[model samples]
Target chain A: MTDWTIDSLVTALRTRRISAVEITDDCLARIDRLNPAMRTFITVDADGARRAAKERDSDLAAGRALGPLHGVPMAWKDLCAAPGLPTSCGTRTRDYFVSEMPCTAVARLVAEGAITLGKTNMTELALGPFGDNAHHGHVQNPWRSGHCSGGSSSGSGSAIAAGLALGALGSDTGGSIRLPAACCGIVGLKPTYGRVSRAGAMALSWSNDHLGPMTRTVRDAALMLGIMAGWDAADATTSRRPVPDYLQGIDRGIRGLRVGVPSNYYFDEVDAEVVTAVREAARQLGTLGARVSEVRVPDPVPLGEATGVISRAESVTIHERLLRERPQELQPVVRTRLEFGEHIAAHQYLQALRGRGRLTQEFLRAVFSQVDLLIAPTIPEPAPEIANVTTGGIDEIIKKMGRFSRLTRPFNGLGLPALSLPCGFSTRGLPLALSIVGRPFDEATVLRAGHAYEQAAGWVNRRPAIG
Target chain B: MNPSSTDPGVTAELTRLSDIIERLSRGLGLADEPASFVTVLEEGAPGDD
Candidate 1:
């Protein structure tokens, strides 16, 4: 049952080899068995999911047209409102919060016949990178217990890896989606900012936040993106950039495509094992007819720091009322991080915002001019142990957590499309990932390149042992 | 750098990062090109209908 990918489940349902109800039941059984150790779900809607599957079966029996994701079971990060489930955002402060309606993104997925199994757990307020939640017990990495499943989309990543769900929606303010994907040996896409609506999702950093899919396969990512990416009048930031048939060009192959390897910044402090795995991934792409070459990237320390300033300031603004009212409810680390944002000067936040545009355009011109995609390690190293991160001194904890996000956050500032897929495994058997980045609104090319590399590298077929 | 550091120390570190960011952006000559609100606008032509 853990072997069923999203595509296989879709094929089985559409071709009548399996009923939607049966698939949903199998998924529920798996969740029941694995979720105690994994703690990937905050809420499990067994009744609602069962009812939705029955309705889907009725529609299929009547020969009605099916949505692209008909009868596929999935989950949403607790950051987003799902109609019946509580939107916890992984904090005690939000324990009682539930929305009147599903977020625009989830609404679209439901309309397309995807069943919401439940809401996945996340970091408290999505502030930390290591899937650690003092409120909800830290999410255990299915690849190995005690090791981390990256955050703030912790459960979304853990669930997919443990075979509790086929695909899940994970939001990324800064590497929330990709970090977990890398750690869990899955595929995650942080679609270009504003490519999907965030009308009803919890706000972390409004400017940097992106909503995208985390799945086991690149094709599933493309499929989910097509269903969810488009203009939403509710979320004006969503691009008028027309959505493409992502799966249409996905298998087109990356023959002769230019792939850029950053000469600096990306690999500066990366682990030797991670560098070896990513470079080997690049070599595989080159062998598959893509020209892989090293290119200079602008010093990213400033850019990454700029993104941090903007995100923290914005996050504090969003949570100010809560902090002022119920400061005691937040986890200590999240509270301290939010309170620290109050010290960032208004002029400095403004300067960082202004620098963002200059840096984004400069990066586009410098890198994309030479390559169609940029290849780098998704995180500097493999996932560390959860206890190691949470039990450390505050400064050491911040450094350990920030290390995973260093390579990924700069892209959030630029708002480009980036995908993280498993490239190889470390000697300790932890998954390592390579990120594929492309020009804004060019997710098709990113997916195509990732799909091609995934096929060539062949790392995603191996599943983590959850039992 | 203790987990239990005083608020003054935390504030000082944040202030230093803020100073660094301000210095870094001071000469970029991007005063007129704000980045936050352009994504929803007409691609780069923000004022266009």
Candidate 2:
């Protein structure tokens, strides 16, 4: 069975064209077949999924009204806690640990009648951009074997691309969500930092972390975001601002919208194919009546560094007790990075924290003032071989990881909404993506431009030949 | 400090921290700026619209 975008699946399920049981069973069977090959899931709750799907069918037969996501089978990254299941967060330290606490993001989806297939795999502590995990193994690219899946949302990307689940919840600290989406050739959104509640998701970086959806289609992302976005007492950092109907605005079209194509920073030193594809995407958006033009981006190096500082410092704080106790249980790179974060002087960490507001102001004034949204490449290059990224020395590994995350990190620092939608494929068949970044709390516009470009390009639904 | 912090890559990140400090100290008003932290991640500013 092909992966059904939520919008399509909902209609089919509602009309009895496909039973929830049939869809769940199909996905579970695919997970069983693909999990060993690509390592997309750490666990598959087959019995639980069957039971849940049965309940959905029963509810429908009973003439009960259901939530928007009724009977939809979706996966959650291991970072999100689902009651009675382990939230491994892609490390041996917590591989067997199960949390009973409810994840606000997962609950929001489940409350809308979304059924959990299981937790998808990820990098250790949600670190690393290459989708590698010493404990979980790498989530290989679904398009082709042995290529990077673009992680720490590794398995979420692979699973969705491989059609193992309809869509999945992915968390982005630096570039986790969008990177995987780009690599797996799916759509991923890193909503503004406070746009989604992160109460029960594993916090890799307290300040930089964002929870968003990784889906097969842009409209699916809009539907999922509308379900999950809003304030929650569990996460005090959540915004009290009203969440917009993302689907309603998704098809608004980019007519007359000022779209910025970065003249610097984002395009610097990127792969030629990636640059070409995104430029072509921007050109297509222009054809759709978006007034796309080149705009100078403030030097992104400082912003990236600040984002790294905040992420590192917050990760260290989160793992302090673990590092002090069971450090050996962690992945060496994750452990090493956490160890390094300990040395960041309090004043230095505070500087990055306080500077964010002022820096975002500078960025918004210098760039966003001229454009309603900015379009850039989600990654510098297409996915590389898994061996090429994972076997390097710690220093070499860190450098490679930085390149993978560079374009996406600055947005995390700015706390802007960025959506990564597949623009085209590389010569090697790996996917490249265009990023649509909008103002804080303006995910609606971001998704709108993405949906518009996606329809014009007709690239997103061109499924990978994995299954 | 963990000895790993001495690695060149990690050292570079610390150095970037200093660069940010220097940048912020250059009349950017970092001192009076609240850490803004994660809670304030949504609103750009009251008048940002």
Candidate 3:
């Protein structure tokens, strides 16, 4: 039961080999055993989970039709608003703030019959790259207890890796979801901007923020995305285009596909071990009949800087009132970082917006013209020790912490879909991941490539030692 | 009214802008001391003939 994937768990539930109550209890027990040391969850509603499980069991017995995620237990990042739960946004200011309504993503997942397990911890205001928050204790990586679980969806990644929950929802603004997944060795998809509705999720950057799924495998991620993706009237930015059947093309191999590898920027200053894992994954893709070729990405620095400018300007606008009223309520590091946004001139923000469109077009023409998918390292290095990070030195901290998302933020700027999958373990025993980015609104290709790689490497079979 | 007739108003607005910018600079973590803020305001303020 502990080793079950989302697919296997669903099969077991249908066969009555395990009752929903039993599955819920097992997960609860695991959480009890592992969560104290791991600090993965900010809140765990054990009674609510068990009650939902019992209701699901009754529904099953009554021969009622089930949704795709029926009987599956899941959790969400604390930044997501879950009714009656404190959506703290990883800050002391909102410590007593209970959301009046559930986030649209959370509501959709719940409607699909997934039982809510709890909310996972995150960095303050979902701002930092590392997962430590003074509001809630630091969330530790499941693979190595002392290391960081990359932010700001740290708890979601740690919980899923530790088997505290089967799957979870995470928000990615500059690789928040993918970074933690890479560190924890799991699958995280940061859907194209507006691919998934951001209606009820806390806002970080209106332009760069994305809502996506974190799961144990690419297939599981696809299933979660299928349920989560769709246009919402509440969010005007959401595309009115149709959402694809992500699970429909799982068997589609990477044969005859063009896989682009960027020659510059992404590879520079990358840790040697990460480079080895990514190179090995590319070789594996080649063996699977993928037409791998070198493709040049525009100097990522300009794109990254533009993304920074836009994100900071937007974030400052979002938190202006809070920053003015309760400045001290935020973590000192997060406060200092947010304050930097005030320096962004209005013209500079406008220029970055214009540059974003030009860069996106250039990237699409250069990479997609040659390949169906672009592959790169999800992070430049393995998770660092929590104690080693110094938040006081903002520039140094941003440089080190920002490296994980350098390859990711550009895509967000362009609103392209990307998936991060665990390829191999790092030299330090932490997980190493590679991202397969696809053209805008072409998540199917990204998922197919990721599924093919998962089949070949079988890295998803490895689980952290939790209980 | 001719736009050039608003020059005196523009000058008064500039003074207000300088005062607001000085206050905002402090809030943005530039300087806490009044003298330091006045120095920044002088440097940033548009020059007069």
Candidate 4:
């Protein structure tokens, strides 16, 4: 029962096989049983969830119009405002901070009749890639104890993996969504910049920040993304383009779709097992009728460096007040991380932005014209022991942090839609992933390719040994 | 900018950005372009590209 995906739960609820209250109670019970070990949730409003479930059941009985996610139990990363719950962001600074209003993304989900379980934990201020929270407890990877559930959307990833929640909303500045999705063996989608509104979410890097869905299956991601992606008056950056029915074409097989295999950069320094898994994922796509071709992508070095410039500068600007007013309240890693961005000059930050345009142009000309989708590894290595990486001094930890997001951040700079789903598992049992990237505003293509690969690889059905 | 004003972590990051800035400046010719980060929209105007 706990292992059921969001789609299955929704089907059961609609058919009266299970009531919404029963599903909500089961999720609450699982969170109660496993959350102590997993630490995936910052708050669990079991009573509120039960109440909402009852309302949903009554609405169904009354023949009320149902949303696609009707009565689905899910959680939001603590960075998003959840009205009653405190958006702590895994920092001591906001330990008791409660949002007066709900964020646009969560509001849309609630409109669709999804019941909130509670807010999950995250890296402080969404700063670090590894989900080590000095203020809150660690979000443990359900695959193995003592291993990291890649972060800033740490708890969202862990909860989905551990079956504590059906799906979760996570924001990505760099690789916050994909890294965790990859590490925890779930499906994570980082839509093109401006595809999803960020009205009520904490701002990390305004230019780079994106809200996305992390779920157990690609179809669930599609359903959640369809609900969340659209124009919002609150967020000026959201696209005006009409939201496509992502699930309508989701089952469209990738026959004759051009798949690009990068000739350089994405695989550099990647672990052998990860490379094999990604390559095998591409091969599986080939089996599904995708035309695979090797192509040279724009050098990611400048793109990555440019991301650092823009993200750091923007973070410093956003947190300047907090840093000055109460720096000590933040996790040391997060504090130092934000502080490092203070020196980035206006000219350098601008240079990155200008380069972003040039690089996006070059990427479109060089890659997208040749292929419908590009397949790459989401991360270089499997989840490392939290004890080892988080302890090797700040400098060492920072260096390792760079590696965790090396592959994913470049796409954020390009504003391309990218998806990370479990492709295989390492010998030590951690999940490895394949990233499928598509042109701007073309997430449907990326999701379609991912769905085909997911069906072929058959990794969506593998549950972690825990809970 | 003297590197000694900040701690090693800050200095290290500054050094990295400096290298990247130098490369981006040289590799991508944007001398004529203004460096803009966020895409600003006029009131009541949609901001999709």
Q: Which candidate is the best by DockQ?
A: 2
TM-score ranking, best first: 2, 1, 4, 3
Interface C-alpha root-mean-square deviation of candidate 3 = 20.1
TM-score: the better of candidates 1 and 2: 2
How far off is each candidate at the interface, as Cα RMSD in Å? 5.7, 3.7, 20.1, 5.7
Q: State which docking tier applies to candidate 3.
A: incorrect
User: In candidate 1 chain A, what residue range of length 10 has the lowest lDDT sum?
Assistant: A93-102
Give one digit per residue, the lDDT tens place, for model 1 in A1-467: 68888788899898999998998999899999888878899899999999999999999999999998889999999988887678889987555455555688899998999999999989998888889998878899988899999999999999899888888999898899999999889999998987899888888898899999999999999999999999999887888777899999788898999999999889897999999999999999999889999999888877778888889889999989878998999877788788877777787788888777777766776777788889999988899998888985676677777777988898888888999999999999999999999878889989999999898878878988766
All models: lDDT?
0.86, 0.86, 0.81, 0.86
lDDT of 1 by residue, B1-49 (tens): 1123466658567766867686767757835456554452234221232
Which pairs of residues collide in model 4?
A: none
lDDT of 4 by residue, A1-467 (tens): 55788888888899999999988998999899998878899888888899999999999999999999899999999988986677787777654344455799999999999999999989888998888887778889999889999998999999999888898999999999999999999999999888899998888899899999999999999999999999999988887778889999899899999999998998898999999998888888998999998889988888788888888889989888889999888777788888777777777887877777677667776786688889999989998889977896877888889888999998888878899999999999999999998877788888988888888888998998765
TM-score of candidate 4 chain B vs. the reference: 0.51
lDDT of 3 by residue, A1-467 (tens): 45877888988888888888999999999888888888888889899999999999998999899888889999989888887677888887554334455688999999988999898889988998779987788999989987889988999999889888889999998989999999999999998777788887889998888999999989999999999988898777777667889999788788999998888887888989999999899999999999998888777666666677778889999888789998988877788667767766675566566556555656666666677888999888888888777444655666566665676777777677889999899767899999999877778889999999999999988987767
**What TM-score should be assigned to candidate 1?**
0.95
RMSD of candidates 1 onward, in order: 3.0, 1.9, 10.9, 3.0
Could you give me the TM-score of model 3 versus the true structure? Answer: 0.89
In model 2, the Cα lDDT at residue A5 comes to 87
Candidate 2, chain B, TM-score (2 decimals): 0.43
Q: Compute DockQ for each candidate against the true complex.
A: 0.26, 0.44, 0.02, 0.29
Off by over 4 Å in 4: A95-101, B1-4, B26-49
